[model samples]
Target: DPPLPRDVWLASTEVFLARGSAGSSDGLTLVAKGGHNGEHHNHNDVGSFLVAVDGVPVIVDAGRPTYTAATFGPDRYDIWTMQSAWHNVPVVRGRTQPAGRDATARGATAEIGDDASTFTADLAAAYPDAGLDHWRRRARLDRVAGRVEIDDAWRFADDAPTGDDTLLHLLVAGDVRLETGGARVIPEGGARPVRLRWPEDVAATAEVRHLDDPMLTEVWGGHLTRLALPLASRTQLQVTVELDTPIEDSP
Candidate 1:
């Protein structure tokens, strides 16, 4: 099939997608979303994103669990997949986004450039009680560089959390090996490992999540990896799909 668009900016929904030109095995597809917490089949993930390499989803959304009485109950937010902390979004002071239409992204904008596409939004509204004055997330897809960069600039109403309260999450449909500034995501089915990099100050942790839910396992195989990074304000994260250099399996 023909390659997807080089750049796509859905301004109304604040979602952006970018893919590399055809013919390069190392090309990447990036998807980013910024909206209210109360989306249709909401996930409380206002600034979540995903990355795919060679049609294999490396960074993923994990979708939803099987529907049940508890799925839509008043305590629906109790579900792990429904929380913002479980998605590829930032967690502030150990708090994720709250549910409700009132919890929305603000000052959202998109730009489709020749070489890169960018989507920026203020996610402070979606995460109330985090003492945030503003949480600005900017995701840029650079087709020329075959990478996606996400920059997060945040300001707190009071003193910023000096401890490990500020964190970042990335759910992956692959094996993750934690490294200095990031992790190498080894995709299932023999796809090459993609590199995810972050600032030096951020500490990375990998948790293996075995999918027991049939619905989740069907889409993501038997397991997934969650890369959690304890970070500070004004952090930048990057995902690079390399054309060369194979990553060796860890013993």
Candidate 2:
């Protein structure tokens, strides 16, 4: 079958909520579900939440069990990837700290510290009604490209560091629109066929087009593209073409 159109928004949503969460009113609560045998590894059972506190929304998860409240002081947010059960575990909205090196060697680790007493004191002084559970929501946006070339750097609002071979989801706020030419769909191996194309005036050894029919959404066929170069940490990348456009509603 021919590859379907790409849905950039849905892909972003998957990336945004890749970490699970538990619903809460004032604060967000994340729970890691799975057997505590300390033997097997499981990613599907974990969950997270984005809590709104003092007008600052933060994400909380139970993925990094090796970390403690002490590891994260009072103030500052951070993103970390830890080695747990032989997997690179991603922990968002946590504390930050300096470390020598990771013993697991699975991935990079990040830490953020928050002075419990000082943080509480500041919150209490500013918003008397604000409690520890009070947190704000975070604004996130993302996008994916299949074959086009990008010029700018990609920025991650969250403190998570960007690295080569890191699978990412580009999230956007509302619907998006884009245009492209000379696109085609092709299937790889046993996986679903993908949309592909070549630019009109670009010279390259291989074809360069957006990946159509990304498995995430039905909007723009969920185009998937790769980075020509590694994305810089906390930097925004410029896209020359509309690889993954957004749609408010789809048929």
Q: For candidate 2, lDDT tens digit of each residue in 1-251?
A: 42322211122112222111123221111111111112223222111112122112221122333444633543112322222211212212221112222111111111112210000000111111212122112222122221222122222344446444322112111112222422222211122222222243322121122423232223223332221222324233322222223223656
Model 1: runs farther than 4 Å from truth? 1-3, 22-26, 159-161, 232-244, 248-251
| Per-residue alpha-carbon lDDT of candidate 1 for residues 1-251, written as tens digits (9 for 90 to 100) | 65466677787788877777534435677788887877778888888888888878888888899998988889889998998878988888878889988888898888877788788888888888888888888877787776778777777888554346888888888777788877777788777667887766667788888899999988888998888877654434444444325746799
Model 2 lDDT, full chain set: 0.22
User: What are the lDDT figures for the candidates, one per model?
Assistant: 0.78, 0.22
What is candidate 1's local distance difference test score?
A: 0.78
Error of 1 at 185 (Å): 1.2
Scored against the true structure, residue 86 in model 2 reaches a CA lDDT of 17
Model 2 CA deviation exceeding 4 Å by range:
1-108, 114-209, 212-222, 230-251
Reference-based TM-score of each model: 0.89, 0.17
